[model samples]
Every structure is written in structure tokens, then in C-alpha cells.
Target: MSFQAYIDNIKAKTGKTPADFKKLAEKKGFIVKGELNPKTKATEVTNWLKEEFELGHGHAMAIYATFKGKTS
Candidate 1:
């Protein structure tokens, strides 16, 4: 799937947009000051999403990539 398609599917499944995930990640300390903390590991964030959001690995990675300002 395309990046946008993956993003749209995630939102449809979770009812949370990319912006919403950023806010949630901030509250969870994955992000700080509107940016992903440099020390944060992808596994940590992906594990959280897998546990809390029940997202698959790929989907969780998509969100993580989004945090890194990726669009592809």
C-alpha cells in the first residue's frame, strides 16, 4: 500500500489521525516539544502501539515514521 493508504487505514481503524498520534505519543513521552525524542527507540514506541493500540508491526512503524517527518 501507499504511505497515505497505510495512514488512512490506520486512522480508519484507530480513529486517530497522525496529529492525534503525535499528541498521544507526547503524553506517553515518545515525543517531546512536538518532536520525537532522540533517545526514543522504535521498538519502545512500536511495542506501546502494539500493546495499547493493538496495531501490527507495520502499522506501528508507519506511525513511528510519521513522527520522524517521513511521508513515503
Candidate 2:
């Protein structure tokens, strides 16, 4: 699937936008000031996404990409 398609599907499934994920990631300390936290591992975020959000690897990675400033 395309990147935006993945994003759209995630939103459809989770009822959250990228901005909402960013807020949650910030609360989780996975990101700070709109960037991925240096002390946080990608797996940490991906794992949380998997467990808490029931997202697949690719879908979780898509959310992580947004943390890294992906928009397209």
C-alpha cells in the first residue's frame, strides 16, 4: 500500500490522526518536540503500537515515520 493509504487505514482503524499519535508518543516519551527521542528505540514505539494499538509492523512503522516528520 502507499504511505498515505497506510496512514488512512490506521486512522480508520484507530480513530486517531497522525497528530494524535504524536501527542500520545510525546506522552510516552517516544518523541519530544515533534521528533523521535534520542533515548527511544524504534522497536519500543513499534512494540507499543502493536500491543496497545493492535497495529501490524508496517502500520506501526508508518506511525513511527510520522514521528520522524513524514507527511506524504
Candidate 3:
């Protein structure tokens, strides 16, 4: 799925928008330097998403892809 599509799916699943997710990630220290770089490492992102958001692997991966700009 495209990045937008993944984000849309996340919204559907969590009832939160991409912007809201971004803010939550920021609060969790997942976002840094004003961007979520593709090279940030999946494990880190996955852990944060799982721990803070209680998202499953699929959903976390979708969030990762969106951050990496790889989904599209």
C-alpha cells in the first residue's frame, strides 16, 4: 500500500490521524531532527509503536513504511 493508504489504514484501525501518530511518536522520542528517516532502523520504530501505541506488527510496519517514505 501507498504511504497515504497505510496512514489511512492506521487511522481506520486506531482512530488516529497520521499527524496525531506523529505527535505521539514525538512524545515517545521516536521522531528526531524533525523527520523520521528511512535509515532509523525498524526495530526502534517497531518497539516504540508496539510499546506506546499497542499496535500490531502489520500496523507498526505500515507506520514504519510511511515514515521511511517507502510505502508509495
Candidate 4:
């Protein structure tokens, strides 16, 4: 699947855009001022996404990728 396809599926399943996830990530301290905190690990964010949002690994990683500045 294309990167956009993953993004679209995530939005359809969660009813949230990457922007929305970014905001939530900021609150969780995984992000700071639109940037991902260097101290944060991918697994931490992925696990949080999985537990809180019920996202599969790939979907969670997609969101984490957005946090890392993936826009395609």
C-alpha cells in the first residue's frame, strides 16, 4: 500500500488526521513543539498507539512516522 493509503486507512479507522495525532502526542510528551522528542523511542509511541487506539503495528508505525515528519 502507498503511504497515503495507510494514512487514509488510519483516519477512516480512528476518525483522526495526522495533525490530530500530533496534538495528542504533544500532550503525551512524545512530541515537543511539533518535533518528536529525541528521548522518546519508537516502541514507546507504537505501544501507546496500540494500547490506546487499538491500532495494528503497521498502523501505529505509520502514525509514529508522521511524528517523525513523514508527509507522503
Which candidate's TM-score is highest? 4
> Which candidate wins on lDDT?
4
Off by over 4 Å in 1: none
Ranking by lDDT: 4, 2, 1, 3
For model 2, how does the per-residue alpha-carbon lDDT over 1-72 read when each residue is reduced to its tens digit?
Answer: 999999999999999998999999999989887789989988999999999999999999999999988889
lDDT by residue for model 1 (1-72), tens: 888988998999999988899999999899999999999999999999899889999899999999999976
What range of 10 consecutive residues in model 4 has the weakest lDDT sum? 25-34
- What TM-score does each of the candidates earn? 0.94, 0.95, 0.64, 0.96
Point out the worst 10-residue segment of candidate 3 by lDDT.
63-72
Residue lDDT tens for model 3, 10-29 = 78877987567667767756
Shift of residue 25 alpha carbon in model 3, Å: 1.3
- Which stretches of model 4 miss by more than 4 angstroms? none
CA-RMSD of model 2: 0.7
lDDT for model 2: 0.93
Candidate 4 positional error at 17, Å: 0.4
User: Candidate 2, which ten residues in sequence have the lowest lDDT sum?
Assistant: 29-38
- Model 3 segments more than 4 A misplaced: 1-6, 37-39
Report lDDT per candidate. Answer: 0.92, 0.93, 0.72, 0.94
Q: In lDDT terms, how accurate is model 4?
A: 0.94
